[model samples]
Target: MTEQGDTHVKRKMPKGVRKGGTRFPRQTLGDSLAWAKKLVAKTHLGPQPEGVVLSGVVGNSNSVGRVRLSTLKQFGLMEGDSKGYIASDLAKRIEAAPTEERSALYRAAVLAPPVFKALFDTFHGDEVTHAKLKQRAAELKVHPEETGKCADVYVTSMVTAGLATLDGDKIAHLSAIDMGTPPPSPLITEQGDTDEPKVADDDGEGPEDETQPEAPNPKRAIFNVNVTLDSSLDTEKLERQLRLLKKFGAI
Candidate 1:
């Protein structure tokens, strides 16, 4: 199934409690945990652009730019050049389980980790700084308070269960993977080899093709275009050409 399909399936809660009731603590926790497990199962970790994951979760480049630097430090998911926090190992385990067992597995995983709450708190606080969250809450057709609460609980559950990590505020770390640097280009070696091609001299005794090309001229190029029009040209066409010339500063 698709990742979104898995998320939808995982988000489904048993029909025992009201839509937003704190009274059904067991059910809420169970549902959150179950959802977390499914998310973990579906996610993969690798070197993704900061923009990709952040775009998936957060809207607005301004919000993302504000949070990424601080969040990465707080989560310890990435260090220096190597970007970390793809997915947690727990997510993989839960995803491997049977469909029927996933809910319970998620529940257990979330409850097992203490850092989940901390991660949730960090992001929840960060999200409020952006106006887009409020806008998104309205668009989703839910009260902002309810949406915020759901986000908090859901993120916390995912983190606790090892399905997600706050690698950065804008992007969740899933799949417990690390990204490596790209390999060097093979074209570099080929170009180096071509640099020293031997050329036969007129005497057939010495190399003549080893020299490199001369440096390019640093002076800028100058060019002009001239258009000749008859004095009796159509007024409308002349006006349009004049306007174009004015726009290009060639009038």
Candidate 2:
């Protein structure tokens, strides 16, 4: 008994190996097959080639193109023939898959309070109000890029559910609000008639009241003068002086 116990004793693992521990392996082909089946069922692309079908369904394919195509092929859900990778017969076995339940991860990405606020506040028209989103993300200490990614995911999911649409790149058009028809004409006040005042009324005088006033003329005055000079006065000089005085208005 003692010898068997000693033989069964376990040794301490090396630090590196201990640190690594038992890591979960990547999903197998069967797991990926199940995932592919779910994707096809959700998207409802019939028996077409996977590549062409996926190209139409997914958004911003440049980012996820290779991974998406390879993943579908890695599983048994699709087979690559002479034409291209075509969805397998197993795709038809899946009924329209139920709408995916929102996990905590999906909720955090889409329906979180902050995300809802950002969507409500930033959605002015087709384009997001980037300034408002940036400010909100800064206050929350969340990276602006991550906030934008969350917004994009929410928009994409909503669009897939037919709640919204992508008008163009980075632009989403939401369902319109239902407002009733407008009234015919606006209300206005009518203007009363206006009359001009007579000249006498404006001057504070009655038309019938009159008083006589007299006009006066004044008489014009005439003056005569005589001048005496010495006999020794020079006639030419006097005449010249008189002419000069008349010119200067002294006469």
Candidate 3:
């Protein structure tokens, strides 16, 4: 039962927990791609130890190093446990992915982290501002101090993902419609000439002199999509969502 701004957090703030700030900085995707490329090049030399890789590629084994590693992991660019760090599937793909697909890949990675995932899912089809998101973090019972930071992380990540845009003090969710998929093209069939039977004018005695060909029937592609409307989503948002679906080949 607390408030962060216009939004009211209906839950208590969690206590005594630290670690894991934002999933990625604004340029995290680009940095990850660059890092992955370097790592790939290094792998050609030999199987280097994790410490050597982290230290050599990044800076010292302190704040900067830790941040880089954490950000990479959040985007699924790197994978490792107690053993150490290694390139993840996403990392490899990113290295090989085309320039256009890079943004999508980056977004995918950013959303992979739990913090970003929860935030995106909770706000899907909803119009929320930065303050509201902070309030939401508070309602989720995150630490009071972490609320603003969490909100910032969410906003930055969303902006990078093209899911949200800044509007004055508020961060508005991009209309899903603008990003939604286009309607599927109708199937077309080319008609070919066919022989037709003729009837005798007299009592089925012989075939008629002139015969008429039957018209061809082309099958049209029918889309079966169930769309649930949300008051929070406007025409623009709906269009964005559709465009996104189209881009992802969901439609």
Candidate 4:
């Protein structure tokens, strides 16, 4: 058994690792969108041969070109295999949208990448840092050297998607979090109507239960916790996990 804070894995790092632990895009979501727009304009969103697709975008199927294609695929903006390529429906929607009306579209693309969603969920309420992001990326099995660029792309994408507000080393402030859903309609309608009859004429029924309960139910057992973590720990995830625990009534 390993000692406390021991992070050693049982096996060596995998061979032929192509990129960082967590998969990250080669370019920002903004850049992906811009490129997708241009490519679709040239191809008119139809399926195209590899050579045509490459020429339309990066002008070659070389390493840089392949990375750009992979990045767009990661963002769910383009779709193709070795045989052919085309812009996705979501990409077409964004292309059709006016510049000012594309915020929600961009947010949808931002969350399309699994890494983007996972990172956002982890650091949503915390003060995010570049070092924190890079560390977290490395922990996810990304190549150590690639984590820095991964962090840069993630931050820029989040900013473009309206999911984050970046300021210097502080990456995201979570200014706007739209998980591609409209606000839940009020449980009681605008006319103050409800489907279920009240179990009591009382007030749980009060403002405390209105949105979501802030405190644990009295019937649930509770214990206090104190933790000590090293720099290797992704401390921001602690908050996200705690919220999940409370949200699921496991507190």
Error of 1 at 163 (Å): 17
Give TM-scores for every candidate, taking all chains together and pairing residue i with residue i.
Answer: 0.24, 0.23, 0.54, 0.61
lDDT of 2 by residue, 1-251 (tens): 47655677567743212122111112233334345555565445444454554564332245354444444453234555424455554433432334453222222222223434345334524454444444555455555334554344445544443334565454453423311223223334334233443354356444553663332334633444344555687999788767876775555
Tens digit per residue, CA lDDT, model 4, 6-124: 87567554332354356678778878888888777766746777777777775656667777788888888888885888888888899899989898889889888777777776777
Best by lDDT: 4
CA lDDT, candidate 2, residue 20: 29
In candidate 2, how many Å is residue 88 off? 28
The reply for model 3, stretches above 4 Å from the true place, is 1-34, 44-48, 175-251
Off by over 4 Å in 1: 1-45, 57-82, 112-251
lDDT of 3 by residue, 178-238 (tens): 5473332334433424334334356633434556554344574445666565778889988
lDDT, candidate 1, equals 0.42
Q: Model 4 TM-score?
A: 0.61
Give the best candidate by TM-score.
4
lDDT of 3: 0.64
- Local distance difference test scores for all models: 0.42, 0.42, 0.64, 0.75
